[model samples]
Target: MNDIDAWVWWLVGAAALGIPLVVTAMPEFGMFAVGAVAAAIAASVGGGAVVQVLTFVIVSVALIAVVRPIAARHRTQRPQLATGVDALKGRQAVVLERVDGSGGRIKLAGEVWSARSLDTGHAYEVGQEVDVVEIEGATAIVM
Candidate 1:
């Protein structure tokens, strides 16, 4: 144990931290692994245990501070290039069959889809155009 280099220990710690980062797909663990790598660099430069530990802590904290807010901002960002299902909302579709609350079919996005009226009392006749209000499961709710 005494013969093992301090840098080797730091590298081992970095590898250990990397396992969770890969398994969990969490960015924080990767940050910690980066910190461990920094600590390994410090140890290679003859930094004592205290210096290595401080390097790890400071690097880890700095990375967390920077990455977390960017992650949060990314998470809060609005729709980017809506897909077919999301784009279906508020778009017009022609009723292929009598669409009531009980369920029917519609031609939406060049495809046939199961649909129902958003309002139970209202129904759209075949060939009538309706706006898709929402998609619930495999069904489109229209009005």
Candidate 2:
């Protein structure tokens, strides 16, 4: 172990940290891996153990403090795009069968879908147009 270079150890640490980043898909581990690389550079330049450890700690802490919040902000940002079943909401669907409180059918987005009236007392006749309010399982609630 005495013959092993300090830089080699640093490189090994970086590789070890990188494995978790890849396996878990966590950005924090990647930040630590980057810090290990910085430490490896310090070791290669003949930095003392104190300097190498300080370099790693400073780099890792700085990355955590700076990058984490930015990453979190981006991660929490919701896309405005609506797709799939969400697109069905508020859409106009044509009643294919008499739609009542119990059950009925409607042609939604050119697809046949089971539907129910939002108002139990309101029944729609065939060929009537209704607005989709929500989707529960395979059924679309219409108003």
lDDT values, one for every candidate = 0.94, 0.96
Per-prediction TM-score, please? Answer: 0.76, 0.77
Pairs with steric clashes in candidate 2: none
Ten residues in a row with the worst lDDT in model 2? Answer: 78-87
Best by lDDT: 2
Query: Candidate 2's residue-wise lDDT over 1-143, tens digit each?
Result: 99999999999999999999999999999999999999999999999999999999999999999999999998899768889899889999999999999999999999999999999999999999999999999999999
Summed over model 2, clashes come to 0
For model 1, name the residue pairs that clash: none
Question: Residue 142, candidate 2: how far off, in angstroms?
Answer: 1.4
Candidate 1 C-alpha lDDT tens digits along 50-140: 9999999999999999998999899999778888678888889999999999999999989999999999999999999999999998899
